[model samples]
Target: MAVIRQLDSLAPDFDAQLELLLAWESVADHRVEETVAEILREVRAHGDVAVISYTNQFDRRQLQAAGDFMVSASELQAARERVAPEARRALEAAAERVRAYHDHQKQESWQYREADGTVLGQQITPMERVGIYVPGGKASYPSSVLMNAIPAKVAGVEEVVMVVPAPDNQISDLVLAAAAIAGVDRVFTIGGAQAVAALAYGTEAVPRVDKIVGPGNIFVASAKRAVFGQVAIDMIAGPSEILVICDGETDPDWIAMDLLSQAEHDEQAQSILVSPDQEFLDAVERALEKLLAELPRREIAAVSLKERGALVAVDSIESAIAISNRIAPEHLELSVANPEKYLPLIRNAGAIFLGRHTAEALGDYCAGPNHVLPTSGTARFSSPLGVYDFQKRSSIIYCSPEGAKTLGRVAGILARGEGLEAHARSAEYRVRNK
Candidate 1:
């Protein structure tokens, strides 16, 4: 029973419709902040002992020892062998595509000299170590491994340590295969808040890293959010979401199935559609009912669509674009004729799917763009995780005597305006000595 709110009839209540469809608000409650805080402190104090206790309690699995927790080379090789040849080929193809796309995002350290011989530039360097967390609960996303680790590897990070949960002391073969493809240096069997804490503070086995990245559950997100100052984090990701904008003429079945595709992700996931025609809206509703019946995750999809999804009929496509900008969805699909016409109008969206043929799922798997997009309406400010996340920048400036003398006056004036004598003296000293 997904809510169908007709925009024509409820023109004055568009705000309410927008609010109902915004699942991020509910998911952004930060409910586990205090819980994560306690776990982080305990893990920080007790180290590996705390991690083992929490894993056994929450994961309902026992680890004989810390040495047994680390994935051995033989174990990884066996997991790789277990992967079917076709799946391996597909993983390799995906790795190739991901590597190719991120290779272009690699940045170079640059410098330029002025007439006075002031050489000012930026020096790009890779982080010494980085940690990537991969979830292993109800679903396994091998693609996430490639998305998180490949960028760090390309950036020349010294070490890329990975942590994946073992709910029942089991890690999927696909995940291990993905780790191999992405060039992870170490793989640890840990997850949830403890995994994040271990990466941030460094357990006996897991090494502390300069930064941590990847997707995870609520406890994991809360732990990352809690340990922000100690180590860098990519972004505070919320639940997955997708929004599709269509004209009245598009196929209702296509629209309905597209919405459900993202809805099946989880109960907290949201799917939204905006169109101007009432007839098409009705058709999509019927299509959802017909199509949802066949899905294996029908119950989850039903709960998600009924509670968090929406269909809004705006007065026009222009109105739809305006509303979408305000919402700032993670994945935006334009199911309209000549969608490029509206491209310039989109000021906010993590990833833009061009037309009816370009569904969000394509972007999730094989598309060139990283699927690790900003969630919880963060597209307004944040960007997708990329090669830049793994690299650090340093200011490079070599001012010759003439260059220092030429630049000192301006620097001294600005320093004086700010009432900082030390800053002014430093610049004055350079010029006077020169």
Candidate 2:
């Protein structure tokens, strides 16, 4: 049987156990930080030379110049052609759905005039350029390309520069094909801290971007942290997580498989089930044991289950929800009969899987919602990546002569109270003599 822990909400030590289970420190180690810092400094100083050197060393590629790292337009088209017909169709379909979904998230400029003839509103505009990092080699993710690039395009971003490490000069054609479909403006075969540095501080070969988004290994994560002020970045994602709040009505096999889906991501990934049914929990436990032997990633999944996974028995569905809110998991599955009824009670979650039929895997792919989400309980404040992330908003305030005069007295009083003589005088100058 799997070594998953079983707990009851009524237990005296339940709170402490839950806290221990939820705790995870995503901080990069000192060695990684030191390495990344050195790379960032080198890249910032040497530009293309530093990038070329690091790419050659890390990716085991023989490159004479930085220009050779760029993937040509013909290469991208060839990748698209190389993909199987069925896979191409699936990619196109998924891209269309993702594009359509993010279209709703696009913000537009809006203004309104007050009675004093003052115009106040907001203006929305897209970032000129963005860099997206796609993990390469055996861990290639085509879905990530569509998820990151499509939203930027939908938001009217002019350039989407993508960087992926081609280890041993072997790149996944699926990833390249997806990039082509998503309308990426440029592609570079570079990875790690060097690629991030190239994007943050532009080299002659790689242009600097307004924002950098996507996932990478520890070195890349540290680089993103190191260069935060230089360019905007997406959230520092932690391990994948899934919290299933079942009502004991769903099939044990289905719930067990759902938990495994997240656990298979990695040993650090978490999968938990909260319900009021003890019998149902036992059934799921049995199902887990039976299914664990079948999965290809069973070793990793088993380790995750033993370390972080849990089967918690609560007093009621309401109690389960309260616990879930405290956990604030990355992916939440309301596997109960009336999932919608409980949605309002969910205060924090990166994404909410609505029904028993709606699997978390769907959201990762063709479900239309951007799967780039807040992880490690960050859903409490952060949100999923969307078109808004690619757009910037500027507050618009045009004060008419009459409006300035009307508001100057209030501003002058506030400025004087703050002990700023210059500010008071500036506002006083705008005030008309009565």
Candidate 3:
């Protein structure tokens, strides 16, 4: 019954066996949320003929219309000239290092002034369109198309589109040459929840998209949780976590191949491992039983290491980073030897992977960041998938009639002490005489 499960961070109901090994229960099943709420009310009322009748009934495809769901531009330039010049130089070096790490998270428009000249800051912008989904039949993620369309074309998104699903008509020419080397713009072949209801309710052949980033299945995560407020969505993700820690001087077969790289990503992935060395957690449980029998995904990492893997023993390394900030893992891996002196005691993680030859599969492809993280414990709140999730800030303000009469008499005495008589007569009509 036990292949992996060593637990005991001084057991005695060790936090109720680590909350029953990080209980998952990822919702979506009232007959898959009534078949994704009737496929989002039949694609918001038959748009593009209900996304070409749910892409010819769930991608078996014999589509006659909805312009046979786009994919042109000479089929992304004939799949970037039939790839394999060593996988198009590894998809143009993972889309030029994920577009130079989301061009250092772009974000511009500022402002300043004050001393009664009043003007405040912030503007940002970006999302005029975005969509990205990807997960097609039998997985071929060209690195989830450079981690979801190179951070929406490095956050200057003006289009992007994408989608995937082509079960029988088949898709993935390295996900169309990593969406023409990550400058996506368009491509479809439709997917589940009707390509997220043709990119969240817009279809004369899909258009509406102000935000919809990737990763799907479960009727595209219940149609991106039913077209979230008509668009913006990027986190319904769960299953896939790592944890790691280790200071027991590495290599128990490199922490059992970094816990079988998120336990071969399935059967609800978790894979844990802490250490204050109980003989390095019995030599990484016999190197996860001799590399889980030379995995070709050993039966989905042996039912995700015999149901949500583990291997603790801690009592130090500050009780394995306070049990890794109470399981807020997505992928952590500090394999120690001073991995930045325990990386500012890691508050919560979506991606950490420090020393011991840092590998959470090199941040899942060319390590340029945004592997679209924040799973399970939602890294305590949220993040990863950046170019600041395709920008959008706003804020600004302007004022200045002597800073609107000293901020309109301090906003008309805090808007009539919050009783709000028309917000205190609209801040006493800018206070010239209030």
Winning model by TM-score: 2
Query: Per-residue lDDT of 107-133 in model 3, one digit per residue for the tens?
Result: 898999988788899988888898888
Per-residue lDDT of model 2, residues 1-434, tens digit only: 44688989999999999999988878579999999999999999999899988888888988889778999888998999999999999999999999999999999999999998999999999999999999998787999999999999999999999999998999999999999999998999999999999999999999999999998888998899989999999979889999999999999999999999999999999999999999999999999988988999999999999999999999899999999888888899999987888889999899999888988999999999999999888999989999999999999999988888878888989999999989988877877553
Q: In candidate 1, how many clashes are counted?
A: 0
CA lDDT of 407 in candidate 1?
Answer: 81
List model 1 lDDT by residue over 1-434, tens digit each: 34333444256776775665673543244457877888999999989999998888888788867886798767776777789999988888888898899999999999999988889999999999999999996578899999999989989999999999988777789999988877888999889999999999998888999999998877888788888889999988877888889997778888888888888999888788888887888889889989999999999998888887878878788888988888888999998999998999998899999887887888887786799998778899989999999999999999888988978888999999999989998999988886
> Model 3 reaches what TM-score against the true structure?
0.35
Q: Order of all candidates by lDDT, from best down to worst?
A: 2, 1, 3
TM-score for each model: 0.95, 0.98, 0.35
Model 3, residue pairs in steric clash: none
Any residue pairs clashing in model 1, and if so which? none
Count clashing residue pairs per candidate.
Answer: 0, 0, 0
lDDT of 1 at 335: 89
Q: Count backbone overlaps in model 3.
A: 0
Off by over 4 Å in 1: 1-10, 23-31
Q: What is the C-alpha RMSD of each candidate to the true structure, in Å?
A: 1.8, 1.2, 19.2
Better by TM-score, candidate 2 or 1: 2
* Residue pair clashes in candidate 2: none
